[model samples]
Target: MSLASQRAGLSRLPLRAAAFVVLTCVAILGVSGWREWAARDAVLKGAETEMANVARSLTQHAEDSLDLLDSGVVGVVSRLEMDGTGPSTIAKLGKVLEARKTAVARIHSLAIIDDQGNWLTSPGTIASTLSDDTFFRHHQLSPKRDAYVGHPVKSVLDGQSVVTLSRRFNKPDGSFGGVVLATISAGYLSHFYEQFEIGRNSSVALVHGDGLIIARNPNNERFVGRSVADAPLFRDPSLQRPSGAYRFKSPLDGAQRVSFFKRSGRYPLLVLATVDQDELLAPWRAAAISRMLYVVALVMLIAIIGAVLVRQLQRGQRMAAALVEKEAHFRLLAEGSSDMVTRIGLDERLRYVSPSSNRVVGWRPNQLIGTDALAGIHPEDRPHVQAIVDAMKRGDMDEARLTYRNVHRQKSEVWLESTMRVTRKDNGTVDGVVAISRDITEQKNLETRLETLAIEDSLTGLANRRRFDERLKEEWARAYRDRSSLGLLMIDVDHFKSYNDEYGHPAGDACLRVVAKVIAAEVQRTGDLAARYGGEEFAMLLPNTDAAGCARVGERIRSAVHDAGLVHASNPAACVTLSVGGAACRPAFERTAGTDSLVEAADQALYAAKDGGRDRLMMSGEVTTLLPKASGQ
Candidate 1:
């Protein structure tokens, strides 16, 4: 062949080789991309299946709980019909209601009301008549024998949100004889829903057929009883089936989510389990991006090799330098991340720490490098971090996302959420872990503050009535277990309405604050609690205290308030004086002497104190007698 022609053929050879390499690279990436997409679809499908199963399980559980509650109500109804509503029969009914309430953790209260909506038997005192309540009216109007679960409402007894399940009882003439009620706190279902770890921005909800949200995780009190009848989750024909999945935007929070829903087989209830689409696909997107980068890099490297074979050593060196530049770019991206990026070695030492460590944990890269990464973890969180690290090392977990506390340079604890992946060798041997951590201390602190606001009274800085009720129940149960006396003192500001009308609302509030402080000071035991029961009323719960002790404390509280000398021009005493009543009893599981009875007794004594004379403490008994005068009195 001629020299020019041979040279042309050789150049064409290189060109042909480059074209072939490019096509092969494209083909490989195309197949890999298809596989990755398939994998992503599989992950999503698996998640949907899992969520469906969760929805079904939760629905079944809710149905079973309701059925059990309904059975209890039915049994009570039968007994009431057989025994009638005499004092003895009411006492027996009270015992039965108490036993049911004790046995069922979810039941907040159990009561039977008369035709006039007066409670015939209750676990606690019914603070207000439920004559106008929806459930009460429903039972009075509709003679349905089925148990009806009502929308959430602030319970009349303790003022916490509760879902009431009521069954109507009939008189001999078949007229309504009021309803037997079983209340479950909406907080109970929310708390139960929190047990499942779905994902960030995920939610689980139990909704009634009428579209009232009975309970939900990420529990917002405002939304608990709200109706979502017009929402797509309820209105869409596709979602009305027994069980299904769909993508919809949440009406409550306005977030788009993949929702799985199941209708209860027994009750007019439904369970919804939702996961945010962004969160659900986040891992898959990351994996796809990583795979795409790997494919691109491999194609670039193959092209470089093909050029090197065509153009000898000089071109090969340039292409190698280009590859190095790409590596440097990746390193720059990692180091520039706001999150602390770290790679640990097989020896459990940090092989690399991103520069962001200084911003995250106030530690320099060199300070963290070559050191045990878990050593900086808070003592309480070290074990969990160690377990995750150990799992990564053992290849038991290929990826893990964990939240833990880390010790900052100032000795303050900082919460960090870390996403980590296990690195492996070509032979599939475990190498180390690569982790990215972001500080979440502020988020956690905000959550804590929000939680505090929910349970605290902004005015008196005491636990609100809701918290007080919860603590009282807990203490009552504990005291019952120990066979110890539980004392409850009810205090009311004498002529408080007149004070409010005379002093103006703000000054009246200040007077109440002083009274709250006095009560808190008098009940200073660690387990004791003082709370603003309502406007112009306060209560103190004394665990392990007897009637005499409670009376002494009550007297001290009254004396302290009288001494504070906040003038109340409208009162007979001309000062803010308290009328205190106390009752103490050993809580009994089988008898009617529960927290409610103690409260009722204290209330009766409080009324007696007001009737005898203001500014005195009274103890409940056959004949209410005044407490001995304080030293000054």
Candidate 2:
């Protein structure tokens, strides 16, 4: 051999020794990595399954608490409204809230709060210490539902985290009254997570859809309420695995660890199981060193045989490298497409996120990779979106198109039209959903504007006759159902034919506009609509407003029209006055009343107003005594 060959020969002994050591280390690393991956995956799956069971168990336990609360408040409100009394109401509310304290320990107290924000009762020493609470402020304004569950908050009663469920009571007229508020404990949630059997360095966190950390186990002093929204696993663009191992510096311990993550329902929750990387590979590392020493001793006895064997292995490695390159190239193309692609699980979490997310949602690819995709939807659209998702999960609907408003980055709202279809695997299992959302706010707004223009009157800004009649029909049905009162006012400009005879039609038009404005201003209440019935006659439809309220509005309109300073000399009626006649009668929905009869009732009242000295109001019930005008006059 040449001198270089001789040097290579001398180095061959050490090189063989070193090659055995390196190969042994690589094999050990591969085996240890595989085992660590499996162990971490198992730990996450077990913990997540356990936590899900805990959530179910706690839901059952809390069910009775919620139902009891619903029953108690319903009874209390019913009695209060029926009796029209407030004396024993507060005491009854306090008793019910105190009674449930054993089941829900976090409730400081229970009380009734009116719409004006005055608490009727309080629990324990809190009543003596503080006089007012915002809990009732929010509850009174809320719609009357079974119960209003407040977001989790620190209790004023006990200084512990809890949620309050308030039930609203309505007045006899269907107006909202005060609310009965009951606070519920958060202890059940903590108890639920405790059963998960988290390892020494393992943790489970519940994050809100907005990334607010709701709760966690092995509670870190700093990470409990903080948003891990900026973490690389949450913000990076390359993460697309459903349940995979990844290395990241732990926010709590500040040590590099391998974590396996599984996301919960599109509710902004993530379950992570982590272990220190060095600790996981410790056993395999030791085994690898031991194997390298044994291989070095064997290689010394057969150097020439090892050289041929290494050359064949190198050729095989080159072939494997070429295949890996092709696979990677295709994966990049699939992930980087323009379509808004996602893989959703049966549980409604995102299993995969494509690079298209950056353009579609203003989020980097990894920002929502393992996040609950449902949480990204607008609150108003959640039910519909979840329904479709659930249907697909149950194999009901295959494709669906839904449009809903989504909040953009700068707090502006944008409407998106999402087209979603089911994705299935070759083995006939659902992989997830692939959806494309295109901005459609402009289109929806245009459609809405066109619909509004069709329904609304252009000049007077009141509902047209069509809309008014539709509303009257709706009110008629409601009044019939509740056995409540309904009133209609037919306002006719006094001697409009004579006024148009004297002044030009344009002046008559101006007078009509002014009268419409006055009539509209007088009858401004919920369920009250003023619309041009036809010609100069404007009709006001009032539901739930009794005869007294209608009379008050009628007098106000009479005064407002006279104040407008328009002149009408016909029949010596007051200057520019409207002779308004109201028919106050509860409409029957099922048993029909003739339209002519209803108009006749109002028309009779108008004649009564005209005879009772114009610029006056007349009701259907009092028309006979109010006016006895001769038909010819």
Per-candidate Cα lDDT values, in order, are: 0.82, 0.65
- The residue-by-residue lDDT of candidate 2 on 1-633, one tens digit each, is 233234334446545665875566566656756765676566555544554554444334345555666666677677767865366766765666567655555444455666665656653523432333544656556664556654455545555555456677777887777776665445544555566553455555544333445455656323444666777767766644444455688776686666565554322344555555556556656865676566555644455565666666656555544544433554476476775666676667776667766666767767887778887678988898888888887778789998887766554677778788897755666657777777677798899998888777877777888888788878877887897777778888888888888887888888889998988887667889988877788888888866787777787888899888787766465478888888765555324453344456777887899888778898786322223231111
Candidate 1: residue 248 lDDT (0-100): 82
Deviation of model 1 at 477, angstroms: 0.9
Cα RMSD of predicted structure 1: 33.0
Cα lDDT over the full model 1: 0.82
Candidate 1 lDDT, tens digit per residue, 421-504? 998765678878999999999999999999999888888888889989899999999988898888889999999888888878
Which one wins on lDDT? 1
- The TM-score measured for candidate 1 stands at 0.47
For TM-score, the strongest prediction is: 1
